[model samples]
Target: MKIIPLGIWGGYPKANSATSSFLIEDKGFHLLLDCGSGVLSSLQNYISIDELDAVILTHFHHDHVADIGPLQYSKLIQSQLNNDVKTLPIYAPNHEKDFFQKLTFNKHTKGKVLEENKEYAIGPFVIHTIKTTHPAYCLAIKLTVEGQSVVFTADTEWFVELGSFSSMVDLLISESNLYKSFEGQIPGHMSGRQAGLLAKEAKVKKLILTHLPHFGELNQLVAEAKQNYKGEVEIAKVGKSYFLSN
Candidate 1:
């Protein structure tokens, strides 16, 4: 399996860029990880909207779910244009027990709810979720395809339990939205050092710091994470793909 960063910024995208989003591909199944701000415009560079298999959201934060409305509209328009009512399933954590009651517009698009910690299959992937420490309800996601696994922290602050949740994954994509200097100053987000600590505890193969901050030199995040994790550490770059190894 290979994961590509469609957009890397955290709260908002940089000039002419996009906010947090990713694409995971395996066996021709394309999974859109998050549909944040500017994602639709940036996504066209790689795949057409119709080609998307599914979208899994981490949270309802503006930076993470901004493009969802646009996505729904695109799906609506495309199905009408092709005269094909192909429905796209958008899986999100079921904050409610009865999430099937979510918006199901003409079968063009639908909502799928996931119960936290319960395993579910989405195409070629086995997925799970855990709640994150954020203002709004959020979930950190884990995807396993074949023998490899990946943990996307989504958006979270430092918590000891995360170590076991992500344990021994092939890759741990941790959010490094804050710098070490601003460690305690921020809430609901982890710093590069905290991300590294989580990676170290999880014993992941490689660490990729994502949900990047727009300010400060990004390379510093890598440096800080390396201070705690002696493994391969790198910043997530847009349009770049990271292949998982056995």
Candidate 2:
């Protein structure tokens, strides 16, 4: 399995960067993790939008779902060029009915509601979702392929349950949105140290810090994470790929 970071910034995009998008591929199957601002352009750097097999949204925040409209339009254009094109399947939380309804405005996209804790099979992956502590209804996703497991903590505050939820995974892609100095000032995001502590408790083999804020010094975030986590830690970079082995 391979996971590619299309964008790593949080809340909004940084110069020449985007907000929260990832591409996970196994064999020939492609799964998009999020479609945030400026993601459509970044996605084309790796694969065509129409080639995506499915998309799973973590939440309805603009920074997370901003590119859904553009992606749908791109698929619509592709369908116009080919007669047998199929709608892209998008799995998202069911609470935001109006937002989900808008995503299905055209025939290019098919929106499916994701029920908490239910397992869904999408090609080579088995996915399970759990609610996270965020302003909007957000979901943290766990994807298992063959015998390898990966957990993504989309966006959340510190919670005890998350440690067990992500326990013993091969990779934990967590949102490290704040630095230690700003901890608890924000309610729905994790600081670098907090993210590190969670990874340590979860006992993940590898930790990738993502959803970084543009204002913070990147190196400082990694340093703080290392203070709590003694394992391999990496800061997510746009267009970078991490290969997973069983």
Candidate 3:
């Protein structure tokens, strides 16, 4: 399995970067994890709109799903040009019915409700969803392909149950939106130290910190994470790809 970080910024995009988005591909199947602000432009740098197989959203937050409208319009244009377009299946939580309806407003996109703790097959990937603790209803996703697993802790505060939900994964792509200095200041996002603790508890082979806030010094975040986690750690970069093999 191959995973690429399309955009790593959190909340809003920076001048040159975008908000949370990742592209996971396995066996010629392309699945987008999220489509945040400016993600469509960044995604176009790697793959055409028609190349995408499906999209899975963790929540309805604008920082996570802001580009759905643009992506749907892009797909609609592609369909008009090729006349062989298929509706892209977007798996999302069912709690926010109004938001889900707005996302699927375009004819070229279809929204499917994701059940808590339920596993679903999407091409070569088996997806498992875990309800996460956030202001709005959210989910943390696990993708397994050929026995290799990759877990994404979409956006959540520090929670004890996350360790079990992400146990023994190959990679843990966590959202580290705050530094250790601002742990309790924020209520719905994890700090860099918390991310490291979760990775250590889960015993993941690799940990990549993403959904980064734009204010703090990134090296400080890395150093803080290293203080808690002793394994390989990397700060997510846009357009960079990580591969996992079983």
Candidate 4:
């Protein structure tokens, strides 16, 4: 299984990175995590957006679901021109049920939307959705492929029980948006130190910090996380793909 970071910016506007989005692929099948504003452009660098099997949106925020409409349109056009039966499966929290239904083309069309705490399977992966603390309806996902597992914590704060969701995963793709100075006050997003603490508690093999803030010293943030966690940690880089085998 491979996880590709489409964009890693915490909130857009800065040029360092885009918003939150990722592509999780195994063999020829592809599953996109969050299709944010910058996702469509970034996706062209890898595979055609129309070829994706499904999209799993963690929340309904702009930085997360902004590209869904465009991607859906592109796929619709492709399906018509190429005589393709390709359909897009969207899984999101209950809060987005009505929103996605309204945004979807064709009133009679059906889109697969799931509430948090539900479990589903896509291709070779078994996915479990967990609720997370965020302003909008948010979720963290755990995906198990083959014998390895990876947990993606999308825009969450330091919660004591978060480790339970990521327990013994091969890779924990957690956010490290703010520095220690803005710890508890930041509300929804977690600091680098907080993510490290969660990873340590979960005993994950590797911690991939992502969704970096627009401004501030990135080196300092990584150093802070290292102080709390003694495991392998790598900041997620956009346009880069990580192949995982355990």
Tens-place lDDT digits, model 2, residues 60-173:
999999999888888877887876368788999979899988767467788888888789998899998889999999999999999899999999999998999999999999
Kindly provide the TM-score of model 3 when superposed on the true structure, using C-alpha atoms: 0.98
Q: Report the error of model 3 at residue 59, Å.
A: 0.4
Report the alpha-carbon TM-score of model 4 versus the true structure. Answer: 0.93
- Report how far off residue 101 is in candidate 3 (Å): 1.3
Error of 3 at 137 (Å): 0.3
What is the Cα-based lDDT of residue 8 in candidate 2?
Answer: 92
Query: Residue 25 of model 4: what lDDT?
Result: 92
How does each model score on TM-score? 0.95, 0.98, 0.98, 0.93
Q: In candidate 1, which residue pairs clash?
A: none
Question: How well is each residue in 68-111 modelled by candidate 4, as lDDT tens digits?
Answer: 78877787777778866655677777675577674456521236
Evaluated at residue 52, the lDDT of candidate 1 is 91
Runs in model 2 lying further than 4 Å from the true structure: none
Any idea what lDDT model 4 has?
0.82
Alpha-carbon error at 165 in model 4, in Å?
Answer: 0.8
lDDT of 1: 0.87
lDDT agreement with native, every candidate: 0.87, 0.90, 0.90, 0.82
Supply the TM-score for candidate 1.
0.95
